[model samples]
Target: MLVDQNDQALRIGPIHRSVAAVTLSDLSELSEQRGDSFEVLTDRERALSCWTDPDDDMAAFAVSDGQAWAVLRTKRTHEVDATVLHESLLPAWHVADQQVGYHHSLDQALNATSRQPGLVVAVRPPTLAQVMDAAARGLRMPRKSTSFSPKPRMGVVMRDLRDA
Candidate 1:
C-alpha cells in the first residue's frame, strides 16, 4: 500500500478467511474494553456500552456512556496515502494555533485550507502542541507526528490500494 511519496510500498499476501471478519459487536466490545481500561486509570472516565446489528459486511454498535455517543457500522478497510499526511503535519501545526475551541483532527483544520486529494487520516488537535514543542526544543519529527494508540498490528493489517 502507498500512503504517500515517502512511504515505502507495503506488500501483503491474500487475506485468510479462516479468521472470521471483524464484526460490529467485536468493535463495540473493544470500545467498551478500551473505555473500561481508561476508566480504571482515571476515575473521571467511564466505559460506554455498545452493541451492533449486521450492516453491509458486518454488524456492530458502540455506546460511550461517558461521551453519550454511539457508532455502528459495517466492517470495511481502505488505504489512504500516508505520504501527503507526512508532509502536511507541519503546516497543520501552524493552523492549529488559531482555533480556541477544542479541535479533534488536524485534517479538519486543513480541510478549511483546500480540498486537494492525497490527504490521509485527520490529525488530532494535540498534535499542534506537539509540533510547537518539537520546534521549541530544536527537534524534528520524521513523519506521521503522533499516533494516538492501538495502532493496528504491523503485519496483521495490510493495504492493497497501491496502483503499480
Candidate 2:
C-alpha cells in the first residue's frame, strides 16, 4: 500500500464476494496442460489501476512504484513473456534467507542447483532505520521487497445490501 506521506490511503478493491464449487473434471484436463513456471496475472480479476491510452492500446502499470513498470497490451490476458521475468526487468527487493523446506523442491523439479535462487520476495520495504538496523546485524533484505496489496481499490463505489 504505497500511501501519501500525509497518510492518505489508496483505494484497493472490488473483490469477488461469491464462491463456487469445482468438479474433478474441471481440474483434470486443465491440470495436464502445464503452463510455464511463470503465469500471467489478469487485471480484470485484480483490484489494479489501469490507464488506457487514446493514442494507442499500449498501457503502463507500476508493478511497484519506483521499482518496476510493465507495458501491456489491451487484451484480456496480456501475457508477458518469460524473458521479462528475468531480474533485469524486475529485480529482487527483500530476499535474505535462502535455505528452506522447499529448497529441494525447486532444485529437483527445476533442475536448478542455486543455493539462493534469487526469487521474488513478496514482502514490504522496511523503513530507512530498519534497513540500517538489518545492515548492522549483517542481514540483507529480501529480493524485490514490496507490499502486496490483497485488495487494491475499494470504497470508491459502494453497493447497498438492502434496497431503500
Candidate 3:
C-alpha cells in the first residue's frame, strides 16, 4: 500500500518498497569509502528525486544529514543493497540498533528529521522473490527490514473473545 502526501491510501502490490531511517551518525566517510557506489546529493528533495526517478534504480539507498546527502547504488539488485546496508554499512558507522528508527515512507522519515535533528537514510526494500530466495538460502534480514502493507484494520481483523 502507498500513501500519498495527502495521506490518502492507495492499494497496490509490491512494485517498489523503500524504507527510511533517522539517525544522528555521519555517513560521509562510509559514502566516500564506497566511491562510485554512492551519488552525493545536496538536499532531501533531490534525494527524493533519486529514489522516485525510474530512470535510475541504481541507488541502493540514500543518506542525508539535513544539508548534504548521498545516494548509494550498486550494479546488483536491491536485495544485495539491503544486505550490505544491514550487514556492513550501518555497523561501520557504529550506529546502534536502538539509535535507528525505521519509517515505511520517505515522507515519514523526512518528517521525523524535521521534528528532531538527525541524518535520514532512505533504503530500497527487497522484492518478495528476493526475500524468499534469502529464506531458502538460510539467511535472515534484520528486524523491521520489510513491512507488508495494507495492514488489516485494527477492529475489523480482531474480535472480543468475551462476545463469543
Candidate 4:
C-alpha cells in the first residue's frame, strides 16, 4: 500500500479494492482463443471485486501456459491467513525456490511459458474496498495484488516538502 508520507491516514489516490483470478493455461492456446487483445481485468460484479467468480464472458483475466488453463481463486479464505497467502505466491515471486516464471504482465508471462507443462498465471488487482472487506472478513490477499497508479506524471504544480 504505497501511500503519501504526508497522509497519516489513507484517504486519497488510486486505491485498489479487488484482484483478478489466476488463470493457468497454455500461451498458444489462450493466444489462439483470445489473441493479443485479451484483457486481464474487468469491471466489478456481484458486489465482489477482482472478478472472483468465474464467468463465461471474462471481462478481465490472467493466463499461464500448459495444455489446459486451470483457474485458481483467492487462496486466502474469508479468514485472513497471512502464512497461507504467502506460500501460494512464493513460487511466482521467488524463482530461486522453484522453476517458476514471473512477468510484468500476465500476457507476457503466458507467451514466455507457452511450451511449459503448467504454471500459475494471472492475478487480478484488488481494489481498496475489496481489501478492506477481506480484512473485515478476516481474509488477507497476496502481496502486490493491486498496483495503484502514480500521481500525475506532468508537473502542473510544484510544492515544497516543507510546505506540504
Candidate 5:
C-alpha cells in the first residue's frame, strides 16, 4: 500500500462525508476520484478502535471519559447535560464477538469537530459488517484507521495461536 508524504501516522477514522453522510460506497467513489488507495486490515478475530488526527499535536478525544467531557465542556462554553451525556453519549458501544458499528465511531469523530475547531481526532471501532465487506471486496481501510483494544501489555489477556 502507498503511504502519505507527511510521515505522520493517520490513527484511523470512519468517514469522509459524502451525499450519504458516511457510507462505504460513497467513500470508495470519493477515494477513486481523489486517487487514493484502500488498505484493509484482514484480521477477522479482532475488533478495532483508535484516535488519530492530521497533526501529532491534535489529540481530539480524551483517553479518559472525564478528559473528553472537560475538553467538550470547555470548548462549547455551556453547562453540558451530564445526565443526558451519561445515559446516551457514553453508552457502551455495541460489539459482537468484538464489533462496534462504524456509525458509532464516525459519530464520535464528526460530533467532535462540529463546532469552532473543525479539527478532529477520529476514533474508529471495527464493525464486523464494514470490515468484512471491505475485505470481501479486496479493499481495506487506510492503515492506522482502526485499533484493537486490550492492546498488548502485561496483565492483559494473552493468547498463543501456535496450536490453532
Candidate 6:
C-alpha cells in the first residue's frame, strides 16, 4: 500500500520516525575538514530550530561538547538520497566505519553524548516517493535509512491448515 499523502490509512494516525548518529569525533574537527560543504551553527538553539523545519536536502549535525552544529545541504540538482550521508557526511567527519552508532530516536542520540565525547547527526527520513524512485532505478538505500510504523503483528494473518 502507498504510504504517501494519498493513502487513507496513513492519514488516520501517521507514524513518525527519526534517525540520529553518534560519533566519537568532535564537531570542530569535522567542521575544519568539511567547512565548505556544511553550514556551521554554533548556537545550539539555532541548530535545533533548523531541525524543526524538515528539508529533504538538509541534515543537521550537533555536538554537545560545545564545538557547534553543522548542516549539510546536498549538492545534487535532482532528487536526493541516503548516499549523501553514507558517502559524504559520515566520511568527512571521520566516522564512516564502526566509530559511529545510529539511534532510532533523537533522545537516545542526545543522551549518548554524556557518556562519551562525540557529536550527534540527525537527518530527515526518506519519503515514500524517494524510496519508490530509488527502487525503480535499481538503487539500494543504506541500512537504517528509513523506518515505517504500524508494523504487522506476528501471526495476525495466520490461518490453520485444516481450515483451508
Q: What is the lDDT of residue 60 in candidate 3?
A: 60
- Per residue, candidate 4 scores C-alpha lDDT tens digits across 85-129 of 345333333323345444555445545555454454445444457
Q: Which stretches of candidate 5 lie over 4 Å from their true place?
A: 1-118, 121-126, 150-164
- Cα shift from native, residue 57, model 4 (Å): 22
Compared with the true structure, what per-residue lDDT tens digits does model 6 show for residues 16-92? 11223443244445555665345577776776676556444554433343345655444433344345667766666
In candidate 3, position 146 carries an lDDT of: 72
What does the lDDT read for residue 28 in candidate 6? 47
Q: Which candidate has the top score in TM-score? A: 6
- Cα lDDT tens digits, model 3, 37-122, are 66677776776677654323444666665567767664443344555666766666666766677776666666667766776676
lDDT by candidate, in order shown: 0.29, 0.26, 0.58, 0.40, 0.31, 0.54
**Candidate 4 has what TM-score?**
0.38
lDDT of 1: 0.29
Go through the candidates in order and give the clash count of each. Answer: 12, 21, 0, 23, 7, 0
> Which candidate number maximizes lDDT?
3
Q: Provide the lowest-lDDT 10-residue window in model 2.
A: 13-22
lDDT of 2 at 107: 21
Which lDDT tens digits does candidate 5 get at residues 1-164? 22343674333333321011223333344435544332232321111222222222222222211112111111111121222122222231111212122233434544444422222222323454555676798864543344444234566665576768
A best-first ranking of the candidates according to their TM-score comes to 6, 3, 4, 5, 1, 2
Tell how far residue 29 is off in model 3, in angstroms. Answer: 2.5
- What is the C-alpha lDDT profile of model 1 across 22-101, one tens digit per residue? 22244346535434211121211121122212223332322222212334332322111122223332232232322211
Each prediction's TM-score versus the true structure: 0.21, 0.18, 0.63, 0.38, 0.23, 0.64
Misplaced by over 4 Å in model 4 are 1-63, 73-75, 78-85, 88-101, 115-118, 130-143, 150-160
